[model samples]
Target: MDDNADALDPTPTRGATRTRTALRRVPFTLGFLAVVFLLGLFTGGLWSRLDRRSWYPEIAYGWPPLTEGKFWTPVTGWVFGLTPGQYLCMAILFGASVAWAEWRLGTARTVLVCASGQLAGILVASVTVGLLAHTHLAWADRLAEVRDVGFTTAAISALAAVSATLRSPWRLRVRAALMAYVAITFLFESTFADLMHLIALAVWLPLGEKLFSRTEHGFWPRTRREVRMLAFTGLLVIAAASVAVYFFPGNSLLGPTGDERGSFWSTLLTVLVIAVVADQLRKGKRWAWWATIAYGVLHVTLTLILLGVAIGTDYATTGAVTVGTGLLWAGEVALLYGGRGAFRVPLRRKITEGALTGTEPGVAVRELLARYGGSTMSWMTTWPENKYWFPADGERYVAYQRHAGTVIALTDPVGPPDLLPDTIAAFTDRCEADGLVPCLFSTTAAVADIAGELGWRSAQIAEDTIVDLPALEFKGKAWQDIRSAINKATKEGIEFRLVELADEPFAVIAQVRAISEEWVGEKGLPEMGFTLGGVEEALDPAVRVGLAIDTKGIVHGVTSWLPVYGPGDEIRGWTLDVMRRRPDGFRPVIEFLIASSCQAFKEEGAEIVSLSGAPLARSTDTADTEPIDRLLEGLGAAMEPYYGFRSLHAFKAKFQPRHEPVFLCYRDEADLPRIGIALTKAYLPEVSAKDLIALGATGH
Candidate 1:
């Protein structure tokens, strides 16, 4: 009878199954919201302010209510809000935050956290107000008699606790935003609700890591990017607070305000100066960091003098605005001190630029590569964006880019293989002497091993797809796609040609540019740089270009191959770089071009054809991956929709190439954040904030 019933019902649909799972996961959140809604309806508080109601005093929690022996107010107050607007906000915020917490911590634990947080916020805030009420501070005395209702504090605490469980980037991002919100509101508004929020956040944000988190917790900024962002946000917050004081100047936690605020023109000038410093801080400028530190110290010193005078005379006329601004300045000073290492970029022209003649670095790097062959990616080191670092002997050089106070070496050093260790050591020593973090990105296993021997950590960041040309043939099921593409191209009258791009006719070059532009136009992001090249790189005479052209002389697709040098200045292989095709002209032209290029290179005695590694794309064997690896994987997933890097990686598998791992080697895991940002800057040098926001929206 059960089997007959199961057969009749069948399995639930995916959407239904997901809905059931979601409902099961957030039972406490749902129940709490439902109870609050019922209470609001019963008390007529859904459309009206509960505080104005006759029965509010009995249920509201605060110092005055607690002193009157209404201990149960803590329990009753959480379900009510002072105003109808607050009720709406409470429902939305509490539902979203608690639901997320329940999803992470489970229903039982989430209930415990929410309840504990709510009770603690109310009792702690009440005790604090009661203690400070007799201290003659106007702000405290005023708040002591105020009663508040709502569970917003619990939502904030729950979110703060969950923040400890997050990984890099998000962990830092959430904590920064939470801290900024609480700090800003408490200092400026100083309302009873604001005090509750500040108290809850202060309790949970630090202690919750021990109580709730399973991951390692450290308060320090992990990446250079985090440091710059935090510093920038701190400066901007100070600027914002100044604007608030000048424009609003309402009662605040520090004291009463209004009379002590400076002239409007002076406030505007201060804000403008802070705005400029904030932008410079975002760029990790040394001058900006020092200037901000000096400004903070000076402001705090002056405020302390004023505070001393007021305290001594018992006049108490310094105002809350000065005290609040002083606290923020002190905070900014501490933040800048903690992250001082990130702000080393000089105010003058970059030290790396034109260290030699303008073209000397690029020319010297290429000559060294020819003298002693490096990894497949070595040719990319000669790109114009790179700055070369030559040792004292000048026998070898490392091509690198300085960004975010870090020196990121590209590929392997160019020189004799025997001098690899010395080259690595020299580069490391130079970075240390220069007070820059050292990193080696997109390098081979040999370089990674050398870095590991020197106590550096290495993680696979990409896989170089290589097709061995000597044994290459299109046969069997694996080569079915390539063979079909070739046959289709033949029938379609698409001819393949290998030539120097610069040698092509003006019309042909223009078509290639148009085709490339069209492909880039579809992505809605700036063209990626770093190891990724474009038509300019293809224009090099040494770089070979393969084209798929129809009988009508229309270009269907184009591929650029960088020459991989062997010993004795011989070209042993070709590494694929730029790959672009006409969106409307060719369907399988890429496969046709790659297959034809392989055959052409094989005829020319090249040992292999490299399809090149896709950035952030990894193989299936993810065993024993580190935290940094997982972070990169998540980043890759987020970017997959916009760039299709993983899709491209998968597409290369059609050629049946063997995967060789390329690694990012660094001195410490803590540097991954800065390195990640530097890599992003290197890739999308032209990408704007608006472009990134648009990309993020598209990803969502």
Candidate 2:
């Protein structure tokens, strides 16, 4: 089965159909907004402040109105806004949020949720204010006499209810943003509307899952990226709260705010500091985590002390602001502690145990690979971006990249097979000691078996396409495409040249760079790293570059090959890496280059030529795939339009090569989330959040 098929199954016609269906699905949302709009227009509340009207208090809901037997206030309140600005804001928020909820939950369910939530919020807030009115709580007492109108409470409730249907990362994000909005607004600007909003959210947030969720994934973060996002959201909420109070502070549910409670400059400085630390937290920095934890503890302890003093002395003011902020801090601390594994990246780079220190790790890795020869991907270990960990014997090493607190070993150890177990064990232990998740990517079955023996789980992530040179021929029907490509290249006078890229003249190198850059410029994301190399990697003397040039020496296409070594420093085969072609030049240039390159290598007595494993692309699927497999399948589909890894995997079938499965071996499923993030970073090391957001916006 095609694993990525389901992800890419939506056609343009199907997408248009879905869009049309969704537009028709939100009738209740449209009706609700219409009712509010028409009511405002008829009552002149859209242009003038409703409070200025003599009959406003009769329709606005609050404790005083409810106690006076104005039982119709709650229903009437939903149809009016206080002013034109409030109408506009409510229309925008309600249109977007209620429309979305209606689309996801259907019109009937949405109507039920919004109506019930509106009534519940009005009653709860009024009752709450009524209970606390004469209890000397200044904020509640002041709000008890006031009334409010709007559908904001209903809008928020609908959003919270639909949050149950969202998938991870977004599910957490929307909920956090909603909670932060209500909490911050109520604490610093406790309007009756804000109190109703908070009440609606509190009541519907947990209950929504039981009512609306079709499939419930656990609430905890499932990926390192989610953990970072949550941490960032927490810090951002803190900063937002400080900004809110500084700009619009007064008597709130949490007592006095702004200058009355703290200095303006101090609040600004605190916000700036928190903003910086929050960014670091998003990057999973260990030092930032510690700093945040300490900040949380300090706030919690101070709040406790203040509460103790108030309780002992019978003080009327309970320092409610401090207590609320302390509670927020406590939640942040709990989140940090639970996801501590995501924050193991240190403030400074530290050497792993038994890591090469005195000499260049890349040089050591290359020498070891040359001396003892490893898997098809062993040559990739020599890349400059990798770090090498040596065993006690100093003869073996594993090349890995540290990202998102994961030690992602690229392939297998480059040493004797007999020492494989020891090397794997040592690496795992070192990662454990360093508090890093350990995993191997694009590794051989031997390594997977070894990892399994050490209690690790393995899943096939890609298939390495290998063309046995001795058996390769273009004489049969299966080789029709290859033969046709070669014939076309010959007719066009496309000459093939294989040489060390770095030895080429400046003009040739420039043309090669231009071709590669043009290819990269077309991609939505930057050129990938890790197992995938580029023109720079082809510049290595040991790597060979295959060029398709016309009679006039205009380069049409280019390909790079890394030598795969066997025992005794023998060059056993070549693994293909970089492949690029001029978009306007030679339609079959890639096939021609590969076929010619294979012929050249075969003439040199090389046993096989590897097309290399296409990242996140599998040749086949298993019936009993795990959750991780499905996750990867979805990721592959999302990335297909940008990177086309699955397309490349399919194209390699033209060569009729044997497929060798490559596995990603890890300690357990718990580490898969971090591993996924680490792999993304390793592949797109230069990708920024803006780039990712843009990519996602493309719906790929």
Candidate 3:
């Protein structure tokens, strides 16, 4: 016990070891930057000369020394900055970028990418400045002697390089934000530093992927039509923003003259061109990619030309603003052109909304079911409340009901096992296309595992009590309650009889209906359907009905069973449903009926008997403590007194049936609330909001 206690202690040595292990796991690039920054801070101005220039000889990469001889400037300049603020900023940017890039591309490649980007950007900027100075361009002449000294360029380059390693949506969002910030900066406040940063990003973006090619595919605007719509939406936002700025008072952001005619026409032409490209891209036109790329190039070129003209004509108040405009355009160009592959999905033949909604599971669907079999709840697919979705192959199908923007499947795909995955995919894809959330309620574990692959979350709602008929016997000590109930019923001359209700006499059927009506009335709620059954489902020709009857043939209780069909239409099992007991009859009649029915099924060579599930009832698996689970627990409590679902589950436990967990599976955790509401509606479609609210007070 002392040894065990000692082992459990979080000792200082153990803590230190853990800390060291975690530190070792951190990317070396990040750790190095952190150490350097701290040391630099402690050293005060030791790294700088009296002239406010870097004390390191290799720090001059541009301006004063544009020589290729200063080969170490690209590497050594990364560690030195003009001010503490610049040093701190570089530390933060490089720390994040290098850490992420090194973690993804490893140390050697990250070093190569950063170094190459820095060298390329410095060389390009210096050469451009020299050429422009010879041409007498005032903007270039002013920038010619501006010493570029910071890690901002290389840091941004690293960021751009690491972006290609990210998955979609995130990849798209990060690249967009990075490029947008850079472009906007250059557009509104173009500086020599900004130009070099942009050059660095451009150099690094393509190189990252060439070295480490990884792709993340997901279904967002999963269809071609969605891509087209997204492009049009983008166009609208741009036009609206442009128009708002153009008409604003004292706004010379676009141009000093503020020529509304040219601006409006130019904006319209741009929108038209974008719309055309989007449509062509939707149709899988190869040239659309290049056309959009050219547009991006032209956009950046025009912005630079305008900035140069403004500077040359002396209309540019601040070179910063002109540079900002140029950078913003450049960033926009990179983002717009960098994500070319995002629109490469081959266009599928257009599926009309009418065809999607009107599709019915016909004869082929029935044949597939007979061939492949399905779950106990699969027969509920024929219920009028559900809509069936069949894949084009008609080999499998899923039934669902839509409410409150959520399309909830009643169970797993109920046809061929091989086609189950594809059927679910098709259903979810349709939901995505129509902008509806898809979910599966009361699904089996196998189906839940399949949904998990599609990134679905799950909550255990109830457990199906399946009794093994072959192993069931009334001799065990645990079977005392069931045996006593049977004995009492026998002494009272009540007989248990299983018969098809369709062949029953009119009087028997009427009595059974009266029992069902009384049960429904006692609940003070509508007759629930979906997985549950009422008198209507019990009356089906194929459903077997069990009756607790007296010697006089008067029925005291009735329980219906739906046959669980095997691959060859053989009745391998039975699912109990539509349990109704007479108000004034024998107290133990329901128990006697269930026990006797199990015995009868055993005699009939059935392998198992399912007592079905109590809706909204929970099991012992409280491992998932998500808010959705808590909310569901509260909901179950709210309706517990009225429905007694948990009580029913407890009663079903008397038989010692194996508890098979049933789950409600859904795509995306963000939609769990909507899914909860949809499940409520699916279970109690006829109950009004007021009725549900008043339920707690009435306690039926």
For candidate 2, the 10 contiguous residues with the lowest summed lDDT are 348-357
Give one digit per residue, the lDDT tens place, for model 1 in 421-529.
Answer: 9889988998999899999999999999998998999989999999999999899999999999999999999999999999999999989876775465445354577
Q: Which ten residues in a row have the lowest lDDT in candidate 1?
A: 349-358
lDDT, candidate 3, 623-673, per-residue tens:
468877776777777888767998999999898888888888877788987
**lDDT, residue 98, candidate 2:** 92
lDDT at 542, model 1: 92
Give the Cα error of residue 209 in candidate 2, in Å: 2.4
- Name the regions of candidate 2 deviating beyond 4 angstroms: 1-24, 215-218, 260-265, 316-321, 347-411, 414-700
What's model 2's TM-score? 0.60
Provide the TM-score for each candidate, comma-separated.
0.58, 0.60, 0.48
Instruction: Score candidate 3 by TM-score against the native.
Output: 0.48
- Please tell me which model should have the higher lDDT, number 1 or number 3: 1
